[model samples]
Target: MPSIKRKVLVLIALLVVAFIAGIIFSPFLRETTYQLKNWVGKPSPLPPVSKTVILYFSTPKGELLSPVERKIPVKKEINDEIRMVIGELIKGPKTRSLFPTVPPETKIRAVYTKGDTIYVDFSPSIVKNHPGGTSGELITIYSIVNTLLENFPSYSKVQILVGGETINTLAGHIDIRGPFKKNPEMIEQSKILNR
Candidate 1:
């Protein structure tokens, strides 16, 4: 009985040592674990495919913003898609009749969604390079707010931020201290599609 007990203890100890060594020396096992983790919870590594997205841009007359159909790469993640949408908006409209609302030099630093509110962070150039007028600010703010709400129904509102900090206004006109909802009245009367 004593010999049997000793053999059992040795077997258990050998199993533990082998398990530890496998963890330490086996790269395949370690890589498999990492891949499993990513497969379960992380976004896919495959590049997002391009999709048609309607982006709102200020018209040349500045009377109201107009919708322009644009093809942009959209990711599986909603935040990533929002970032891509904003990046395309900054690139300006291809049509000569429409113009960009955000500054040409502005860069989107980050984009995130919390509950129904989407927060967009832009570089300081959004404010510094802005044309700074009531109409311009309204177009800029509404263009962003409308674009997000129009594209993704999951988001109800949008909050603009500069360098991750919220300001009272984008260009000292419209109050942007809180999230802004879509204003259908600000869109062009003729261009308002059934959404």
Candidate 2:
């Protein structure tokens, strides 16, 4: 009986050592163990949670912007979250009735905050690929500004930049040299699409 007890103790020790080694050396095993713990309801660092954000797009019939909801993974930092939001905006609206405001070729270069202002830097395509018009430019600019302001109320304004430098305009229509506040006048307040 004593020998059997010793054998069980040895087996337990071996398992503990193996578990420790797997966690230290094997990424796959570590993920599996984390998942197992989740399944077993054991307390573990929760997976990155997702939050719903409202993205603005141009309404097909008129020049006004419309809001659409999307689910995005929550980021550890606010700046990363801002990037994700803008990335989603570039992807365009999921609803058929709403038109995409940002140029498809546009790429986010950087996003940062200072006091109550957020600066969003984009690639040159935002200017080069823009459709070009007062109405079009208005829609595009407000689409980004409204999306950011709506999602993060803490940031009161957004400054648009291109290729790491501040730009005066997207397509020579609206003045973009200064930071922009949320223009509720440009938004279609009644309609909100979920996707």
Candidate 3:
């Protein structure tokens, strides 16, 4: 009967040790288990890390603009997303037939949203390096306005600034002192292709 009592005590002690070990190791076990599950092809609950956006770039003819698809990292805020899209636009199009309206060397200084207007500021290169002409200025200005308004419906107008100051015009043609709306007429109807 004493031996039987000792065996029972040993079993209870083993159980108590196991309980304490489980308490100590539970978090580690859970983390490891989750990693293992992910390694085995379990999909994570997080949203997609990137998304596709359409950017408008001028065709080589400079008479009209066309859509160029770009894949960029997803941003939490709309303004940040717009900045990313604009940055991509500044990078120019991958297709040889298309040309960049904004100067290739132009840098995006800032982008912000207020009410229904989105203000985009560019470095002095935008104005200084731009090919000054009526058609050139129209293409550059409309390309930005159309790209922003088409992709982001929430914004109705876009205001352009050069080196943080409001520019009277981009190239002595179009008045850029105020916000501009999307001008679909500037876009080639036949060239509107989506990817």
Candidate 4:
């Protein structure tokens, strides 16, 4: 009878230990079990390490803007990312269907952010090399404005600065004296083609 009681007590002690362990490790065990059961399928996809920046380039006719997405290394600073995007714009469109808006010779001088506005300073080549006409100027200005505003929606306005000073117009057409907002109508919504 004493041996029987000892066995019963031992079994109860083991059950108590198992219950405590289950309570302590239920979450971990549940996750491990789930992973094991789902192991037959493909592994979960990894998060994207790079980010896409939408760049606007003029269409062949230079009348409207077309957006092209370019993947770039994510930058810790917002200004650095903005500079990267502008640099891509200067590089021009990868697809032949789109034309460059910013002058190829142009260089980004600096990019600054204040409140909801972004100030982009460019080299004088932007003005000197610009193909100046009302439409040309409009495309150029809106290209910069739309690209910046679209990618970074936090910024509501963009001001273009040439040679480190605020410019009244990109090509003596549109008044660029103040910050410009995104012009959705200027962007071609018919299609989104990326290279």
Q: Give Cα-based local distance difference scores for all models.
A: 0.87, 0.92, 0.89, 0.91
lDDT of 3 by residue, 38-131 (tens): 8899665999899878788887789999887778999999879998999988888887888888898998889999999999999999999999
Indicate the residue-level lDDT of 167 in model 3. Answer: 80
Which residue pairs clash within candidate 4? none
Question: What lDDT is reached at residue 73 by model 2?
Answer: 94
Segments in model 4 whose C-alpha atoms lie over 4 Å from true places: 1-48
For model 4, the local distance difference test gives 0.91
Candidate 1's residue-wise lDDT over 163-191, tens digit each? 99999888898888899999988888665
TM-score of 1: 0.72
**Of the pair 1 and 4, which is ahead by TM-score?**
4
Sort by TM-score, top down from the best: 3, 2, 4, 1
Name the best candidate (by lDDT).
2
Ranking by lDDT: 2, 4, 3, 1
Q: In candidate 4, what are the lDDT values of residues 1-195, reduced to their tens digit? A: 999999999999999999999999999999999998888777789767799888999998989999888888888899999999999999999888889999999999899999999999999999999999999999999999999999999999998999899878877888888989999999988666675
* lDDT tens readout by residue for model 2, 63-87: 8998899999999999999999999
